[model samples]
Target chain A: MTEKSPGLFGRLKAGLGRTRAKLGGSLATLIVGRKAIDAELIEELEALLLGADIGIEATGVLIGDLESRLSRNALRDGDAVYAALREGMLGILQGGETTLELPSRGKPNLIMLVGVNGAGKTTTAGKLARQLQDQGRSVMLAAADTFRAAAVEQLQSWGERNRIPVIAQHSGADPAAVVFDAMSAAAARGLDVVIADTSGRLHTQGNLMAELTKIARVARKADPEAPAECLLVLDAGVGQNGLAQAEQFGQAVGLTGVVLTKLDGTARGGVIFAIRKKLDLPVKYIGVGESIDDLRPFDPEAFVDALLSGEA
Target chain B: MFTGLSERLAESFKKLQGRGLLSEENIQQALRDVRVALLEADVALPVVRQFLEQVKERALGREVVKSLTPDQAFIKIVNDELVALMGGQSEGLNLTGDSPSVVLVAGLQGAGKTTTVGKLARWLMQTQGLRVMLSSGDIYRPAAIEQLRLLAEQVGAGFYQADTGSSPVAIAQAAVEAAQRNQADVLLFDSAGRLHVDDAMMGEIKQLHAVLKPTETLFVVDSMTGQDAANTAKAFDVALPLSGVVLTKMDGDARGGAALSVRQITGKPIKFFGTGEKLDALEVFHPDRIVSRILGMGDVVSLVEKVERTVDHEQAEKLARKVKRGKGFDLDDFRQQIGMLNSMGGLGSMMKMLPGMPNVGAEASAAGAREMRRIEAIINSMTAAERHKPEIIKGSRKRRIASGSGTQVQDVNRLLKQFIQMQKMMKKAGKRGGMAGLMRGMGGKLPPGARF
Candidate 1:
């Protein structure tokens, strides 16, 4: 929304600057030494993928493909292997539905954010609300996370900063009731969108999952066809467990997409590849910084470029 | 569900059954499986490679123990190396020398820093009998200070916080003065969770560290964190002198590679682990227990320790005597039994430590706990006679008891049904000497506090 700033590709490239340095350092050593691309270079590539939170299965697949190509003499140098690895990663991400389609500016489009604790659901909600509001949509936030201490206040603070209204209940109130109230209020006020920030919970928590399903159900009671999209806020630093989180949350609430968080850090969040392989849910947006302005629509092309090239 | 590594290793190692001794060639197949398991557990590739090297050397040329399989011998070697690498004995906080020792808690955002502070306060008070004071320097996160204040209130610890808009150093300075004035033995300062890559935030924490001169700067980390845990912990260690670590979210199904990675990178003892969300759920880190878990051997030691620490010896003795007299397991005793699990970080945590036990998910076990509390409430509403003999409660009595407990009449019936089943199980177990017999099976591993 800040047109004066660097474009999405440049911003994400900058956010992922460290991944490029690390990967490029290893890749550079392999490519610059001008040695025959051997098993050692491939081993380093495998390590790079694994370090980026790409699961062993996918890393093995990529490495396996590289090894097979090596046998066939398909890859001549480290440069070919690098391009092949980038294309393979892009293959896992590019074909998925990458964007959220908004309903033409009329009824409220409810989006419920869900994830494990500390995945930045609240911060993403603030950023998303501001992004939508800046794009000419009236956004209201639903502080449905009544469980965590001060979660309501956190959302309210975001509302204050964005000059938006956030519907909240007492700290210990039922989160479903809070969502229902927000949806009803948004309908009354003719808001264009409602962003509900739910409490962070482990997907293995059956009661919490049931509570999320109930929230989605309650939103329908307030406004039919509510919660049009449920986004799982996954931390990029998560390893194989991200698969379980995605699977369980998808089964519990029927996740339409994912919002990968904390990508600004050293983590590449490559677990999204496995998540995509399992559920085919798009990585809609990413959180690149603590500032609200850092949320950007995910671009797989730029992300892959930064991850492999470290330069735009 | 991630199957225990032992079961899978046992399967693959079955091929090497005829081999009486493990040689470099024979253990190569086993080592590959182990490498994969370690990697799947989120252990960093570099750490995994180094660990495999150590495992290979120790596993090679070792005779299988009498009556123990070659796989068991190999697993023992790997487990021991892991424990040794992680610092074998349990390490306590360095709270000596000063009257008001400050323990500064820092970590990544949402890594449970404030919650760990609350748990640490309770742990210090319970173990060391120290009068602890809690303070929050987390000015960035909304209502973060209030969160710590509430936790302090819950734990009976004095709370301190600076005015809004004050920098972290100012809050630490003010809290230090307050702790001295209050004569608090320990001042637990909780800082805002920040990323190690964020230089500005890192600088702020470094500034706070300079101002407080904390006796212990514990780095709190989530157990579910991945390979980057090493880098993050290394960065933090480079920025501050991290005395130890507190790994949180152990209650989840994370493989806990972060624990190994953090220890490998920082070379610091993991002082405690946040087992559950409860204040009393913090546990002292045992290398053997975590290594057992990492190797998929189930942490029976920690489970027994949990039972020993949380189980009230007196209550168990009374129940044992009552059972020995054939007085029958009553509703009151059943309620006590339910409360025990609820107190000991829920049945979910217990399930995780038992080998071959199905992890019925934290949510399901949490639901089980809720059911226990409801049943306890129903028992509390009953009169002494009704508790002693649940059969005496007629239809109207059931209705009255249900309403008194804020539950439905059907809920009362459900409790009655469940209690009958539990009573039968308790009677069967009681005939084997009850709690005394259970601990008797533990040999001398039982803690001193646990008495027959």
Candidate 2:
């Protein structure tokens, strides 16, 4: 394996230096001028977005949109460039409304969380459960991740603190069976919501993913629309890797929405732009911390502001 | 079609080949290259802007480093600024808390959470000589408990696991109780990993925090995940009062922006690093070491220390003395050195610490380690006389050594040449001084390879 430098901050610092150098004299000129709709400025703008790793496809759309606006006399000057760029980027990002729709007339809205191994699926599940409880919803957790012995115990601990019920099975038991039991328990007890925590398996592991698909199938069997939201928890720090994961999980079990965990620690917040652009899947929630209330519903305007202004 | 930052910088340097001092135009050019590199490396845009403004202020009118070209001086300034942006120095784990301090491990799945638990366990056990207990609260994956158990065993730490059906909070509570009951010094609870930061996961962690109230909560992250690692760390930080970070898979070919970014973004220090899969492969993160590595300088001091510990000093001295006397340095000495190198963790890694040595590509570096085994094979093929006096054996002896070693004649010839070179060096060193002088010489040769 390649020995990458271990610190994200240092690499980013170096990365920034490179990005600045790439901007060249034109960036300064563009920044100083208030109104300038020149070809050179457009070229510099294109380089800037591409440098952000917005991916070529998204970059093309952003640049093309800006070019058309400029040609139509809709955009001019540095202020306009900033506004146009921000508006265009936000427009693409805001295409899909990022609200986690709660199911109406349900004792407990079941959200079946799924993702590949190491995708932060279980933590997202726990955080989501906590966030729901914090929102005044009585929540129950199900440790359906029976493949790992500690997984059930971990979820149970989360359940105990939240004062919620967590239905779990013995290690090595069928995960689908555990979720089935949990869902039944949630529905019977008139729980406000039941969050089923599943095992983290590799998306490429067909058998494992197939097993998850079966669990989803079994979950729907219990309540045809029980899993009100199958939130696929992805690490925002994963860059393009996370995008690939989103695509794979979307293919395997159609993702209702995405939960991007760890937004506070990465520079590739641009992955949000890519996910929005490519998958068109709405980001339902994001994890900013390891607290019960850390998971917040995705707000596009807020996110775009954070991306453009670095304030979240 | 697009140029990477490193390539672009190389091209720009060619344009300013004869410049004495950095003109505003050239600095702008260099900054452009730096900006592109940063963006490509997945740095946050705001951070990039802030950093560039600072660099521009510092770099605009400075004299270049003495005897260096304008490009080299610019590179130096950028490297220094890069180092400064990353908090300047590496921070370590805070074990200054009260005894039996709790350390919470937090991160997404596949971030090596369970494995980090083991690595930390071993580190505390061996380094601090503290009694460590590893408890898996990861009651999500079926084998999660077993994984921690296996890791605990590997690290020689006590393992705690509740039945798979048990509640994690109850299990955590019980494990803390168990740690106290067992008189364990440190209790490490490996929590369940998740795919995203959802309300449910946060609630669980919050609940766990209220119960355990760990002294140190370290968010484990994969450096390969880059910006995602930082984002997850931030989420965890807000959710739980994280004390530090443990970045895993530093051995992977990640660009390593996550390590630097997470701390700056989350205001947490990185305490430990998971360098490889082995239980002993964990390292205490030091910022200077990392910066040096990034600058392509080898970290020789650490390398030599490692060698000293692994190699038998007296035996090496004896071998050096023998070689100095023009005595036959045969298969026995070669075998011993090979054994020592192996104990010191492979020759390829040792070489990697030498400054200015080409990266030897991953494939070649791996093959280099295997080459030692071939050298050992050739030595093993030698007869007693051949082992003692390699000169006595001619072409027939080479053939015999090859056949006995299960290698070709070329292998024997290569070994002979290497052995002769070593002997010649030893003889020259002996004429000047002794093994001490040779070690000193080796030290001088070590820095370039070991700077980072």
Worst 10 residues of 1 chain B by lDDT: B443-452
lDDT of 2 at A169: 73
For residue B444, what is the lDDT in candidate 1?
Answer: 19
RMSD (CA, Å), each prediction? 6.4, 12.8
List residue ranges in candidate 1 displaced over 4 A.
A1-24, A32-35, A309-312, B1-18, B61-69, B308-352, B355-431, B436-452
- Candidate 2 residue A218 C-alpha distance from true site, Å: 36
| Number of clashes recorded per candidate | 1, 131
Write one digit per residue (lDDT tens) for candidate 1, span A1-312.
122222222346465433433444345565543548877777777777887778789889888887888899888876677767777888889876667766865678889999998888998999999999889999899999988777888889899999999999887788889888887788889888889999988876667889999999888887687778899998877877888899999988888899988776677777888888877888999887767777888888777755553211
Give the C-alpha interface root-mean-square deviation per candidate: 4.8, 11.1
Quote the positional error of residue A45 for candidate 1 in Å.
0.7
In angstroms, the error of model 2 at A82 is 17
Each model's DockQ?
0.40, 0.13
Q: List the residue pairs that clash in candidate 1.
A: A206-B363
Error of 2 at B18 (Å): 4.7
List model 1 lDDT by residue over B1-452, tens digit each: 23334444445556667777676777888888877777777877778888889888777644443427776787677777888888867779888867699999888888889889988999889889999999998888777888889889888999986888888888899999999999999999999987776777888899999988898999999888888787789989999999999998876777777888889889999989876666887888888766666555677887788788888989878777766554576887767766676666665566667775433444565565566567778889999999999999989999999999999998888778766765555555556776754343222111122221
